[model samples]
Target: MSKVYYTPWRNDLEMVDKFNKILRKSNFLDNIEKDDRIAIKLHIGEYKNFAHVHPLYIKGLVSALLEKDCEPFLTDTTTYYCGHRFSAVGMLKNAFYHGFSFANIGAPFIVADGLGDDKGFSVKVRSPLNELFVPNLFREVDKMIVFSHCKGHGLTGFGGSIKNVAMGCVTKKSKLDMHKVVKFCYNDALCDGCDACKDVCDREIPLMENGKRNLSLEKREDCMHCPACMEACSRGAIKLEELEKIAQVLPLAVEGIYKVLGKENVRSINWGANIVEYCDCMPFPGRTIGKNTGIYLSDDIVAADKAFLDDVNKSTFMIDGRPDPEIQTIEGEKIGIGKMDYERVIL
Candidate 1:
């Protein structure tokens, strides 16, 4: 079992000080050598959804890394969705708008994937898909500190360090490759002809034929596999199957990242504050589903995420009646990434 350090967000202490205490206790800087290029991997929130880990907290982390004489920089990949984060320039602007600017975080902010999304390298994995693409910049870093904002995720039940490494570290092409496992089947017999799927589809893959909604094979080829249609269909006609494939493949992709960076060279921190129901990629700022629980720090990404999920699920307000968030941890352990069993050390 791995040791996960926890520091509760209390009224008696300043949050930044609490974060500093956690960092001091975690011994995170021990992994960093002098002049080591450390990438602080994190998601700068989407436009209008500024619920990610606050830049103040990141400033604290940067200070700690600097104290170790390590070179630290903030890095994230360009998003796949059609939004402000779809390109490198736009993503940097969005990150600046959300207060993750260089002046604020005390580090250079880089979109790990290049301007046109062509800068990445592939790594072989145990999954049947065989390989996953990691951003070229990520490979250059000697070490990484995966800073994640723990929250509920629509596809994976929960998003933390594992999801951060799987989706946040890879290029858009690899993101789509990982998402290809989410097969959506439209049952024509259960179609209500409500045109809901047609209205929400950004790719226009769903068509209205006569009075029924039709998803052609050609259209399926163009499908981006986002769950927009699945969420819009109230009649249960469009069903998302093979979600276990996602649980299995996501950790494998994370393992690929670990293989590139070396398992001992990476550490993770999950900020359990501002726990939103959906990912930070969502355009709108949704409601917070849990209170400011605390911060989790661990060298093991899987153990850190497992502890975060376990703590969040203990709360009454869980997304979709408490879907199994532990699936990622279970799969992570099965693939030799990390262990689900952890020893929580309260600070």
Candidate 2:
């Protein structure tokens, strides 16, 4: 019996106005306590990937939180991959540069994991459930207000609030462990013997074979398995063997996040415009595959995400320029996490 609020609008929309309407109608402001340190969880888009939730929208959210005397801070953990937000220093710099400054969004940025990347704690959810994911920073937060930029991912189909928390709240180590699928592999057909993998390998072990650099894991147990070499490989020759395992990790990680959040302290808001078919973590911006719908508010992460998918399908700019809702879930129903069956009240 969860209530989800829908506020549909076009790209030509005023974020501040939408914010006030949504906060008021959804009674989100009513749930806050004065001076509570609220972690406004959100994705600060990777460099050159600009389809993230708007900073202006963040400003409006911050303003609403301030009205209730809630102390809000924009926060997200560093990614495992090497990128603008891969480390605390780099992440903070990227946050500020992306207009997430206290002066701009009316909230300070906080990296959930510590400077050295060891500030996170782990929590186990669904004692007997098969899924086992551990969140680094989710357990440390007092409260969380998730703001998501709805989009599709090449790997997980759709990226929404659940995906945001599953990936966003964890540490790099957790991400790596969860995403680890297979060992490194190189295609001789594509490899021009550039030895880029060898150059990036921390252990300096992978050697060239048959005119191609084949990853040698003789001391594979000693390797940090950062996969930097795999990413750096040109011609897409080097790859990890475990796509299914990496995909399996996202859902398990989500279950862990839910166990930590424990339902009460979490609220989700999704900004549904610029629905790109890829994650914002990419270094390059991708094309928008759908039209801008307004905001959706719900405590049910699954339902709100489903609502977002439905809106995108119904958007005028869809693939066929018609409604075609088909979003494959990363995992099956998030049963105890939240209900997919929701009452959507249009605002």
Candidate 3:
């Protein structure tokens, strides 16, 4: 059974009606309980990125949840890199700047991983990697209404509900480990005695001498793997190794999500309209990839992602990698997370 439910983008006036029809048709709303502490998991968009799940849509969803007596709260995890969303204060400011205020979205925004990047509770899970996650606030909640703006990612090829939960709901420490696939290698031959890597090294992993420089993995152990050094290099000598390890993190990435929400207690809704090439992590907005494809709702996270991928594939527009792309959510499915084959219900 295809799990994708879709509604075309009509006039803005019909947005709430269209969403309700889609939600009702999908039957996902049936799962909510009265007065349920529903965690409305979402990305509040970066500083300048306007291409996120619209606040209007969120307010509609919030209204729907309120009707069910579900106490919905907007939620997301902070970033690993020191940025706008690295701390509760920063995330709140970014949320406010992006129009995620209680007045606008009708829900209080909460940073799930606590005030700092290190705050979270660990949960054990069964995986080849034995991925453990610091279960965030969503874990304490009774139910979750997962929302995502489907888009492409530099690493995952695409980002959807699974990506939303995996990366958006976990602590920055986990993100550092997951994204640290590539290691920077110093090119002694290209070294110009600039010691550029040493200067910008947030983890202080690189050391500089009178005329040469050396990098230590022991010191770089705290590296968040954000690739800042790759851009700062003046000689363009720093090389990345173990590139293959980067892709491996995708599957392991969702383990934390699975650990927190589990399969039974979560439902997903994704806004595929205005699909973009890059993720919402960008502080600045980018170009849209395809036509408005409406929204989808499902209890199966992998199924929702696969269904969204299929919609992207069916489109005539090219998004670098869309048509016949490998099922990126297979890693989640392999771990008994969710199904991929779905029943598409077009509304």
Candidate 4:
């Protein structure tokens, strides 16, 4: 079985010191060889969303890797959504403003998918997506450290190593591709003209009257496909369909990472502190769901995520109407990302 090493969320020790101890206990970096170019894949968060993994912790890991003579750098991809991280220049500026400077983190920050969001290889995976555009940076790296800040997601319930790999490792187009799988449609014939869809749609995408709409659903796709209209309509006018593929499709991106970098060459480290309600992508983020959990390190991505979510569920299950966290692990295992069973090693 996979082994997940643990360390308490304590402030008694410096962040770097605690990180080093956990790394030693878990042997998380044992696979990295000297002179290897390692990419430390991470989510640096959107503008002012400060719950991301601290740079000091990453600096500690970088120091350890440097001591072993391995070449390491921090990397994350562009966001498909229009925001601070939508482009290479914008992302770099935001990362710098967020204190992820090369001077502070002991490594340079790289926009993995490149400036135009056009550097990648199409590798095959499973259902919901045939292939993913694994960024060229991921393909070139000798190894990767998937460092995640464990938190609740409005979509996947919990975002951890699996989410870090699936969403963070791909290009902009592939990110959009994963989201587009869930079909959203509304029938004008079923409308009761209650204006419920209009009230629920925060983006004002739905144009509902007695019957017929001037705009099509295709035009609504330009906005975030949250499709809140499907739920508020008592008349069954709108139907947003998905088979939990949103949860399953995320793991396929991990398969793409494995296809290029090899599973053995990756390690996962989750910062379970600052447990919050939504993903770091949100501008306002969300409220904290539980007390600060500690850290988890494992080679098995699914195992690490499972352990983290298990702890979160002890206090609260649903952070903010998100899907159950178990669904992510179950779907991940179903798609052969990693096993759910694991042996826990306390540091």
Task: Tell me which residue pairs clash in candidate 1.
Answer: none
Residue-level lDDT of model 4, residues 71-177, one tens digit each, is 99999999877678989999999889888899998899989988947758889877658878877777679999999999877566678899889988888778878
- Per-residue CA lDDT of candidate 3, range 1-347, in tens? 53667776676668767896666566778888898898998998877887888888888888888888778999888887766777889889988988899999888998887886555766654443355556457657888878998876544456778778777776776677667655656678887767667667656766776677766657667766655565467786776555445444555656656656666788888888667766788655456667666788888887887777776653433233222223447666776777787887778
Alpha-carbon RMSD to native, per candidate:
2.2, 4.7, 3.8, 3.7
> Per-prediction count of colliding residue pairs?
0, 0, 8, 0
What local lDDT score does residue 323 receive in model 4, on the 0 to 100 scale?
61
Query: How high is the CA lDDT of each candidate model?
Result: 0.83, 0.70, 0.71, 0.80
Question: How would you order the candidates by TM-score, starting with the best?
Answer: 1, 4, 3, 2
Count of backbone collisions in candidate 1: 0
Give the runs in model 4 whose Cα sits over 4 Å from its true position. 12-15, 183-215, 221-243, 314-320
- lDDT for position 260 in model 3: 63
**TM-score of every candidate:** 0.93, 0.81, 0.83, 0.87
Which prediction has the highest TM-score against the true structure? 1
Better of 1 and 3 by TM-score: 1
lDDT ranking of the models: 1, 4, 3, 2
TM-score attained by model 3: 0.83
Model 2 residue-pair collision total = 0
Is candidate 1 or 4 superior in TM-score?
1
TM-score, model 2 to reference: 0.81
Give the higher-lDDT candidate: 1 or 2: 1
